[model samples]
Target: MSFTQQLHQAAQNIWQKSLVHPFITELQSGQLPLTKFRFYLLQDRYYLVEFSKFHHLLAEQAGNPQIKKFLLQSEADLRACEWSVRSDFFTGLKITPMEIRQTAVAPTAYNYVNHMYLTLERDGFAPAIAAIVPCYWLYQEIGQKLAKVGSPVALYQTWIDTYDSDWYEVNVTHILQLINILASQATATDRQMMQTAFIRSSYYELQFWQMAYAKERW
Candidate 1:
């Protein structure tokens, strides 16, 4: 099995919880409150801002030219995606940049972004890649599944469609391949750090949903 496949297996339980989380299920059913989704969008805007920076930082550290190029491209894509989400949902919901700026980052998103930064600081590239991959993988997985059972709400369906596209899948596959390549050359200790980073990121994925559902503060 590929290294990412093993990481997926190890984190399957956490991923499953995220899939079945009430926040997700409610969104799927088109029963999720707009207030909750708006809160989510705001916090997500914060997360994606830092997430793009994380990619740029990772790209700087990448020794492989291919990987560095991919990371830089991914950073651009992430910035565009973040803006697209903001344009679509924020305008649709009448959320303002002022409001988003005024809002504080929720704990889940703050911790999740910090976790990625800390992983890079302490463990370097491989583990940092592992930490970020769940954001890509889980969204595509959720989007594909939710596309099959699409939301009646156009907004929710639009969100699902964003991740469900073939282009998004290709980007995700590229990163997973990178993971496998890194794992092949990684020391046993580095591999274990990667595994731990993957699991923690997966767990954070689950918490992000809960935070949205509760519109968590502080």
Candidate 2:
């Protein structure tokens, strides 16, 4: 199996739970409370900032020029998406930068980003890729599925369409390809570490949805 396929297999249960999580289901149905979504947006804005740092650090450590280029472009795309798309989400939801600044990071998001940072710090390239891909790949998968069924809410649909796009898919595919290449060269121990990182990140994805749905604090 391809490295990414194996990572998916290992984390399949977590991914399934994420897909069926109330936040996602309610989002697809457009019955999700805007209050809940507002909390999510606030937390997500924090996440995007940390995510850019993770991307830059990973790219800086990547020895391969192609991988570095892809990581940089992926970070750029994330910035563009946040500015052009999520800025409207912030405005329409009446979320202010001050509110985002004032809000403390929810435990789930705080721990989740820390997990990525720690993995990158300790394990460097291959493992860091495994740690981070779940965020992009899982969201793209969710977006693709939800896009077909679609949310009645325009804002939610816009969110879905943002992830379910050609550009996003191409980035994900490139990452998957890179993962396989890295895996082929990885030792057995290294491969196991990568798998563990992937699964842990996947579990965090499920927790994140639950946190937002419950408006988890502290």
Candidate 3:
């Protein structure tokens, strides 16, 4: 199987959980509490800060110019979104910049982002990229699924559209290509390690929704 296919097969159960997860179902149906979504947004901002950092480091360490270029662009996209959280996005919701700044990372958020950092620090760029791919790929898949039913609520529909856009699918393809390229040269052991990283991160992605559902803190 292609490396991307192998990784997908390995994480099939996790993807199924993510697809049918109550938190996501509720969000799509406009049944999710705003407070829960607000909590998710808050933690997600913190998560993106770390994601941006991951790409910055990847850009620096990558030998291939294409990889470096992709990472740089990825970081820029994340930072642009981060910039919007305070003003364009959440301003009307009373979620001030200070409130976002003051919100502590929940345990799930901390573990997920920290795991990304740790993967890069411990295993170098390729595995780290593998580890983080599910966030984009799974979300892209979920977004497309969501687009079919399409939320009735304006705000929730906006979220769905954001993920369903062409840009995100491009990113999914780009990242998968990068991973496949890296996997091509990897030793059997290294490829297996990469698969492990992908599986573990996929698990964390599942937990994140549950965390939001429970409105976890501390």
Considering every candidate listed, which one attains the maximal lDDT?
A: 1
User: Which candidate should be chosen as best, given TM-score against the real structure?
Assistant: 1
Q: What is candidate 3's lDDT per residue for 129-218, written digit by digit as tens?
A: 998899889988898999999987777787787779877778788999999999998999889889999999999999999999899976
Name the regions of candidate 3 deviating beyond 4 angstroms.
81-87
TM values, all candidates: 0.98, 0.97, 0.95
Model 2, 106-183: lDDT tens per residue? 999999999998988787678988988898899999999999899999999999998899988987898888889999
Candidates' C-alpha lDDT: 0.92, 0.90, 0.86
lDDT of 1 by residue, 80-199 (tens): 774676688888899987898799899999999999999999998999999999999999999998999899999998999989987788889999999999999999999999999999
Q: Roughly what TM-score does model 3 have, to 2 decimal places?
A: 0.95
* Error at 105, model 2, angstroms: 0.4
lDDT at residue 120 of model 1 (Cα atoms): 96
Assess the local accuracy of residue 169 in candidate 2 as a C-alpha lDDT between 0 and 100: 91
| Cα distance off (Å), candidate 2, residue 200 | 0.6
Model 1 spans > 4 angstroms off: none
Candidates arranged by TM-score, highest first: 1, 2, 3
The whole-model C-alpha lDDT of candidate 1 against the native structure comes to 0.92
Alpha-carbon runs more than 4 Å astray in model 2:
none
Report each candidate's C-alpha RMSD, comma-separated, in the order given.
0.9, 1.0, 1.5
